[model samples]
Target: MRSCSGWRRFLLCFSLLLIIFHIFSVFEFHPNSVIEIAPKKRNKKSDHLVLGPAAGQGLPNRLQCQGSKALNKSHFLTPSNASNVGDSISFVTVFTIYSTSLDSHADDKSSNLVTVGNVSYTKKERSMAILNVFINFIEVTMPQSNVIILADPESDLSLQRNKVTLYPIQGEYNRDKLMLQRIRSYIAFLNTRLKELAQNPGHTSHYIFTDSDIAVVDDLEHIFQKFPNFHLALTFRNNREQPLNSGFIAVRGTPESILRAKIFLQDVLEVYTLKYTNASRMLGDHLALAWVIKSQPNFDLRRFSKAQAFIEEIDGASVLFLPCATYNWTPPEGAGQFRGMPLDVKVVHFKGSRKRLMLESWNFFSSASDISDMLCLILMSGRTRYDF
Candidate 1:
């Protein structure tokens, strides 16, 4: 009986040990099997705690979280005890272009008459010469900030003191070729300049390209601040959906970003060279750019956000419209018949022959009447404020 009781007690002890071992095996923490826990939401005052399994020694925190709701949970899973970082630094730059001679049309021809603000001129014109005086109007109306001008190096015009930086490019007057290609060449040149800046580690976060004909009616500092991650920004041309006319562009000066752009340009050049011997067929820079962005791995072009129409503020600082009519404003055909009548416009871009003729009519009016009619038309549009 003593032997039987001792054996039974030993068996009970062994069974208990086996059960405990099984329980431990089920709950054991395996490096490979470790599951990520969902973050728990907390109040603003609560300490932001990040929870995660400790990674290898000296590894930076790599906790994956999804959605805004997850971010709101306050808990961040990090490998290390490193503090959570905030947004990265950002900056913006602008460029403009201008010409003294209204006779020297964008089409590379000389015309006798140019009109602005209701005044007309028959002889050679100066900065003061006019009819549809749009450029001068913009300079007076728009925000006075960091404005850079790309122009003919030989042209003599007294730019506002320290307000404009004069950068020159070789003028191409050829209209037979694709206008898009000429524009691309200019953009490529701008990119080269930006790449130089990118090489310096201490480069600004963003660079903006704007046509000399454009006007900034409001402050643009906030646009840069709000969307720091966007690779580019521009006013979408109504005629073409594709982002083109570098009338405006925002670029982040990084080697990777510029390299990607170079690759895109090369791809476009190669494709066009093979398909078309004429310049007109090659006039698809905007389309080509969109294609490269869509096709290339890791190249992001959807990062663009269109500027809203007529609004003064977007998120924070004053938003600037690339003056629709007066600055880069193109008047519709038959705009001249409505002479002296209020035509709504901010920036007027003389894009085609008809629009240029309309601008020429403005030169016929007296200086005072010219300013008054322009202001009245712009305000009558009801979307813009004419403080200038």
Candidate 2:
């Protein structure tokens, strides 16, 4: 009788704990039948007033059906089926950085500095340190993946063979509106790749477009396999006002997919080219994405409900809407209060004030060591949390 009572008590306590954590972020999603779009067109101030800190500050960078089963750990959401990524994958990013040097290697250029949480460091050193975390993390976690970097011609990123490729963005862009320019450059690169790969009928590529300030912690390539039918995989937040973020986009490439993507991008570009309106002003890519979708002729709000939350058929291709908390995980609070996150998290975006957390997270999650990054770590985390 005593043993049974003890077991009952433990089971009851465990059940309560699970219920509590489940409320935080769970995966029981049934997306709405009628998919809605982002609302960037309705609100754009000519003065370029943004919701949060300005774009250059960082220069970067969901639930199932509700009532029926209630999103739980039961059988966490899976994409399609497991398969080798093979040679079909490439990770693309837009990272604008200057020549970087570390401690004592400083020169006159080093005087222009950027600090990460009170730590004195050159802007380039800090940017490189953050970039190293992504580069090294990708090298380890997704060894088969290839990388493409889009940056200013002036920014020199010493490269290696077929693993990493650099495509320089040549021309002048207003520093005040750099984010808009960055997005334009990124889409241009995609267009260029589509043109180059048009003749390669034997192969279909999978491209993961991300911001440089992001570190992919999981084998994100699996997304293409899991959600095989999607042409564009995007991340969205629960917030209705700014629901979609383009920091992590996975393109499941096919000939049709390429054409559809080009068409969609063409419309996004129109927002910038139309000089009369403040096109990609405050919101940049996120705004352009939402506005374009809403303006599309086929966009019918009546079609989306919740049963089909993640995947949507829009434009000419299927766009998979992934939850931001998991794929593009950003710390809700500062690093000091952050312990760690579940390994289920595939990517992390260090935006705005949270850019400082990159080094702290890299040390905790990645095995590769860099004396340069470690040196900068001395100033950051008071308590590092790990959700493993």
Candidate 3:
């Protein structure tokens, strides 16, 4: 009887050990393997959290995809932490190209020695070259995307890229008009398109309208994901509640957002043509948008305080606010200044003489140095040459 009891106890111990081994095997951890937990399904009504960035702060434009070895998994905002983090955000950038004149004035200066992609471009061509670099950089950084270029009837803008689509502006807006009129024309074209998109929201969910002089130095996918709930997102010139910068405005694919853009464009058009307002102030496009946003009903207006629109703000419920500096850094004062790593600068705007200097530098450097180097070079050159 004692020998039988001992054998039974031994058998039971072996079975328990086997069961424990199988349970441990299910969660087996390998030193060299990476485990990417699939995101769980979220409720649809939780869309309100998508309105703003989670505690807006200084975040980089290019976020590493999941399963990366370098970055900490906790550093990134997951679907559990944020509403739209896991959602595949979609956006289209609208670029308006009027004439290739780099500066506001028309000049007979021949093309300079500057060459990009091994193609020699004139000073006028260099203006277009700046645009070429901007577009090429955008395409390279954000692949599998859409870029719509609105070219004047007289302006011959050719972009032979897979994702880029070109549309000629039907307006007879003279290219020789003052820079403000050119801006008015551009906004008109943008508004008309926005109205069309608003009429049919099935094509895309978001749209970004920017000037040709701007270069996107970093990946913008993360930036677009920041303001998922906002119908429209604008960057401010200095502080929140101030005039907005129309150069980098983003809008959701909703009818109301598109209508507000239409109203804003109409106001700008009237200011230049019939309204007889201060052309200088209205042409900025910032004031016009502010006016529209103020007059229009509540439409989820969110503005970036510096660059990462409302990303660092603690109150996620606030629809309108400012972004950080990394969104866009320009040479002109009152535009956000840059004092960090070049890798941190998201977009570089070549304002006034900065554009000319950048065009000239392209001759020496194949492309704009990393955002920091390019910004430093522009600032240093401006200080030494123009006494800025």
Winner of 1 and 3 under lDDT = 3
lDDT of prediction 1: 0.38
lDDT of 3 by residue, 1-388 (tens): 9999999999999999999997677657553332333122221112111111111114454222221111211222222333332323333433334464445235445433444335555555555666666665565445444576665556655557666667665554443343355455556655776667656656554566676667665565565455555545556555445456656756554655555555545565554454334444334345555565555454344443334445221112223333424555554422233343223556666655455555543443345333333333444433211200
TM-score of candidate 1 relative to the true fold: 0.44
Give the per-residue lDDT of model 2 (tens digit) for 1-388: 9999999999999999999877543433524422333234322212111121111111111212122221222222222332354646888887765443244355457456554334555655666667776787677557677788877787666555558888787743445566576667766877776777775566777788888777665566567767778878777765544567778877777766766766666676676456313544446667767666666676654433221336777766788878776688665432123323322456767665445566655653334343222212311321222111
Candidate 1 residue-wise lDDT, 1-388, digit = tens: 9999999999999999999998677668554433333122221111111222221213222111221111112221122322223322221222222444344353343354444344444433423232113344333433233344444555454454334455565554234443344445545655765657666666444445554333233233444455544444434333334544434554444554444444444665555555433544334555554454345464333433432333222222222333222223433322122222112223343332233222332432223333333333322221211111
Candidate order by lDDT, decreasing, is 2, 3, 1
In candidate 3, position 159 carries an lDDT of: 57
Show where candidate 3 strays beyond 4 Å: 1-120, 175-205, 239-242, 271-283, 290-324, 332-344, 357-388
TM-score of each: 0.44, 0.63, 0.55
Best candidate (score: lDDT): 2
By TM-score rank, best first, the candidates go: 2, 3, 1
